[model samples]
Target: MLRWVILAVVVVVLAAGSTLLMNLSTSPGTSWNLPVTPAKAGPMPKAVVEGELTHEFGEMGQQQTGKKSWKLTNEGDADLQIWKGTSTCMCTVAKLQKEGDKLTLKPGESTDIDIEWKTNFVTGDFHKGANIETNDPDHPTFPLFVHGKINPPVVVIPGDTIDLGAINSDEPKTVFVAVYSPDRPETKITEINTSKPDYFKTDVESMSASELESGGLKAGNKINLHVQPGFPLGTMREEIVIHTDHPLRPEIKLTVVGSVSGPISVVPDRLRMVTVKSKEGASGEVRLLVRGGKEAHFDVAQKPEKLEVSVEPIDPVGAKGRYLMKVSVPKGTAPGLIDGEILLKSDLPGVAELKVPVSFLVGAN
Candidate 1:
């Protein structure tokens, strides 16, 4: 009986060991395979809310204010949550609609976001940016750009060039260029400058502060450019640069050309008088007499309390197109070259003025 009992105990022990081995090899929870290290996370797949977007619109006239639409879509596999969307200015606004929960995007599905910007305030080349945030782990945030251009309703009637008829150097004259725009309510003139400062001056008569505040100039609205001629004489060519809020016509160039009369040819075209003595005056003359163009005119105008200037003409009436001018500097002038302009008014419209530099030497005879 003792031997049988010992044998039975040994058998039970063997059975128990076998079952433990089987469980260790075949059980899902007991497998001896090494733990797998998780893969390195990749960059997010969020694309530009909209791919390569652009827009265009008509001028915002009083009656016909036009608008354009820009759309943004998500192309990623996961849901794209727009944390924020904003514009460069108050003229633009963006909106997104919700259909249901889950942020609603299946693989390859897309949603649209509408962007409406007021074209009334925007003219010329326009660039606006929007910021977007997403749930994409790799790229959580991105930028969306909407680019476009606008043309004002007004057309530059004289186009690029204007020729004002001639006049005497002693006389002052004004010329007008007409600007036509059908959409005048939304347009404004931003800036105006001249290429030749001494030869002419310009003013905008039609554009108002209220129009500028409202938007800018539009079509059918007329822009009157008043150009004033300066004194002295010879051939004159200059440019008027006008800047507006219009997107397509931001910068406009107007040309001014004419001729003046004088003798004493001076190379280098312009003069710079420097280092004049305090109690003495200096003189410089340029002889530019070319026949075939309009007759030349010459004059001298002085500025600052201490300086006096005179332009002495060699001929009273220039020989059709040729004449001479002598610049006279007087006593008690300041030490530096007295700076002023010799303006020559011409007989031609828009081309009526020519500017010459007048300089006086200081501390020199």
Candidate 2:
């Protein structure tokens, strides 16, 4: 009975030892402890943009200055970080407060992003944009827009220039331009002035509300400009200045363009006497033609020295205002280049005086 009980105890002890060695071999000397719950999941970071996302710079003119701003708020449980910002145009600038690359904003906190644009680089209508990079998962990037049309404070209708097309010097021509400011309604045109008052004259009248509304002018005045290309004509270019009540833009400048056509134009307006001898001078003749084959009355203003001028009516009376002007350069004239002008008076009201240039190059005799 003692041997049997000893044998059973030895068997149980050996079994328990074998089970412990098997567990150690499988786990390689590892130990087990109480299970740990994972840390509670937290809310993610987010951003809420407020204020203006887009701005309009109305009627921005040359070198005009303006600015716009927007607010950025951190509405998340974690910190809001603004990484950087970029602009589409070098003319536009974006600004923000510095907090390193990790610009931090606590919950419910906000910051401003200032954007400025100058009209010096743009004309007519323009549009621009900017992007702000942030850490917010919802909005990793924020976008902004800027747009508007450009016009000077003293704005001109039909544009900043007047193209009068082709005009005859023998007839009076007039152009109407509306000068006003849609951007500045309070301003008024104080005085209308022209650079060439003789050639380009201006008359102003109070623009009625109906006229203003019809012409799309919110406020300002209208100018009735009279242009007379005068004699000795070709392409004409002039300028008209407008004085305003505004302090900043006290004067507005505009271009005037036109071409002068003559009623009785000469074939060769300039008489060239190239390579002439001292004893025997050069002579030239010019034919005058009327615009519509009508009669034209003209008389010489002053007879040039060392030259004889005569006019003969066209033969057979086939054409009116058609005449032959014969210019005779006398002999024994001094050698050298001779620069002179032929003056003539006409019955035409628009063309009071006409000047024809004469150039003589007398060779050494």
Candidate 3:
């Protein structure tokens, strides 16, 4: 029995040692030779986007128009696929080529995405963004931006408000007001409208029906605004709304500022409400009475302020001769003056320098 046990122990030890040597020799970095293979190539290179991601137009005139192009290049070994392109605004139009539903680009090849946009709305700064989708595994999504400004539809060279300075009722004076779009080819005035129909009249240079439908007006196309100043004389105000077919300049407001030639005068040439305040952000009202002037058409403009200011037409109806104004200030307003002007627009005869003093003060919290 003892001889058998010793032989068994020796055999076990030898077997264990043999297995350990085999594993060590067969290890990856050990004596065992392994077949060599070429290194696996890194992931296919990705498509590279170049050129402008955004285009900007600053205050485009009524007839202003523009276009832009974006370039896409595939630097990878595999082909790049573009699914589709889209724009958020109707004024923007985008065009690109596609093979059926797929847009494919061969290695080292490039393509262009064209974008055209027009501002036919009112004058202001605008911002827009676009999205691009690709087959790139790493970067499947991309973004682009566009920014620009639309010039004020109507540019009153000297000022937005036409200051007729002053006028005489019996003189029958005529002021020649010129209205034109800066971007000649891109914009044209289609129609002219006034709030008060009987007080003003507009006529444009005659054009054939074909010319009117053919887009913008020709050079030297002129529109005349006829102002008939007939009244009790004081301060007169009216708004002239111009309709156009410009992408960015659809409609514009022209202000008529003037005074009638008469002895009647307003104490404050301009009334400006500086500020309004309240403890819990309350409300209030203000009343303004145009102390002096003959009968005339008068209207009030609610300016930018925390409190809502309104005007109520007084007892005498159809009074179209003087500056009889009333403004309502809201209650519970915080203590402070809101900054805003009481635009007393009129169609009197002379340069009416009427400045009305306006200030808002709130009660104790």
Write the residue-wise lDDT of candidate 3 on 35-59 in tens digits: 8897747646376778667776555
Clashing pairs in 2: none
Residue 30 in model 2: lDDT: 80
Per-residue lDDT of 134 in model 3 = 85
Q: Local error of candidate 1 at 7, Å?
A: 59
Ranking by TM-score: 2, 1, 3
Angstrom error of the Cα, residue 283, model 1: value is 2.0
Candidate 1 per-residue C-alpha lDDT over 133-158 given as tens digits, one digit per residue, 9 for 90 to 100: 55766666555555556545556766
Better of 1 and 3 by lDDT: 3
- Stretches off by above 4 angstroms in model 3 are 1-43, 57-66, 85-87, 90-101, 157-179, 185-235, 239-253, 257-365
For the record, the alpha-carbon RMSD of candidate 2 to the native fold, in angstroms, is: 14.2
> What C-alpha lDDT does candidate 1 achieve relative to the native structure?
0.54
RMSD of each: 14.5, 14.2, 13.8
Per-residue CA lDDT of model 2 for 203-228, tens digit only, reads: 88878989877877766777899876
Cα displacement (angstroms), candidate 1, residue 145, comes to 3.2
* Model 1: number of backbone collisions: 62
